[model samples]
Target: MSRHRTIFRRPILLCVDFDETITVHDTTSLLFQLSSSSASTQQQLVTQYVDEVGEFIGSYETKWRQRELISSRSRTFDDAGLHEFLEGYAAVDLRSVQRVVECRALEGIRHQDLVKVASSVQVRSNYAETLALADDWKIISVNWNKKLVESVITQAGVVHEPTQIIANDMKADQQGVTTGEINVKVQSPMDKARWIDNVRSMYAATKPTVVYVGDSATDLLALLAADVGIWIAAANTAASSAKLLHQLVENYGIDLHPLMNCGSVGGRIHNDRPVLYTVTDWAQVQSILKSPF
Candidate 1:
């Protein structure tokens, strides 16, 4: 039995990331692991994904540092700069998806295969306990397959199943087998942020308190848009583990506060600079949710 309750005056909309934030492992990578491709091809697909993403990060950092040196000042992470940087990632994401399709890595997987994979990927502790605190819960992700995400949530027995799942779709053949072609919808950080805005607009009349929880750069923009943004990380990891995230926040002039320190929405929106809360686990999240907001 879980203590399920909400203390907010207005309606609450909780948006969460589906990857490492909710699941114990990244299910997208697991999709390749479960591919019907030969062992060697599977290894190659995994390696290619890592290499390309690594190269992109390395190149971006090098270019950014060079520009900083030439300018003699750190770049301010304003709206325009942030949007440009995030939107530019759409191409990188598309290339990765295209590679998966061209190689036919996930071509033969079926819904049952996804369900089996979802069983192996565990949700964080107290996830359901915390879900009870929200009026509506939705998952906003850049994951390639929506069914895979739904499988994970259904297995977790969340208090409230997501009213909607905003993600990409996989093209299936006449026989219902994956065709290796993915329709890219939420492809970048910018896309995730826009979806958050779209959700907020739906509840504009009630002015719902929106809380976004996530674990990576893809979740950054959406987290910023929420009334309460929580960054969940490994309990043993140091602050330096999120160097890129810290750099972006510091440069952009956003303030990071401990989740336990946050009380009401008033404190979060008191200034021009946005406030993002950090937590190591869901227990900390439960504490805030248990209180009246």
Candidate 2:
């Protein structure tokens, strides 16, 4: 599982997306459940909305509806319409969502409980191997929450630096309850790509090859930009987080959020980039990393 070998003769920079990519469930679901079992705390997120926040979330839901038009059963996402989708999707206000999550979803949640979820949540198969690969190469996690990602990786015994994680954050109070000042970084595919570009610039002298691993359509931009993009098609599997996500959305009678778009099965979309490799098992990832392709 150790990525001692790579296709590039130069150094390798491995970028992994968090959420369903590595974890069995969306990290938000795990974190959202950490709050107290009070009725208000357990209420639907939309129910907690207010003024501009409500409007922002409503606009975000429009993106969700657009994804609905794509059909949950379809696995292949055509990039032909992807540009238009991203243009409309650019309207999503991530800071608003971050604020909502911090103020509402994490209201009654204690910092200790948040840390505890790092161990309680399920880690995908070959996670140790993934971490091992990171140990031997430049690895960074791009996710929505910085603190949550750091805790999960740290608790898993991976010694990744805080800076290695490009994500958003919400501070906590003295009583171990989460508080204000949301610092968001990786909210969209462009943001994720920007981090990769920054890293690429930093390692310009070494001319490192960037390899990105992600599990959903949200990683499309980063995937397209990478020298090698590996898509983890674990969504429709028996233990797929995407299945649960589909079910959750169904219960609410809504379409999958555009950001949560689980692209088609094991196939390449033939985008501007040569192609993207899709894998259901970690072994496939190991195989790809071991070969020149």
How many backbone clashes does every candidate have? Answer: 0, 2
What TM-score quantifies how close candidate 1 is to the native fold?
0.84
List RMSD in Å for every model shown.
5.1, 8.4
Residue-wise C-alpha lDDT for candidate 2, range 59-178, written one tens digit per residue: 645765776787643244444445444444443445446545555555555666767778876778886576465323333444445767777777777786666777776656678666
Residue 187 Cα positional deviation in candidate 1, in Å, after optimal superposition: 1.4
lDDT of 1: 0.75
How many collisions between residues are there in candidate 2?
A: 2
Task: State the C-alpha lDDT per candidate.
Answer: 0.75, 0.58
Residue-level lDDT tens digits of model 1 in 97-171: 777788887777787788888888878898777777777778888888988888887787764434578878788
State TM-scores per candidate.
Answer: 0.84, 0.68
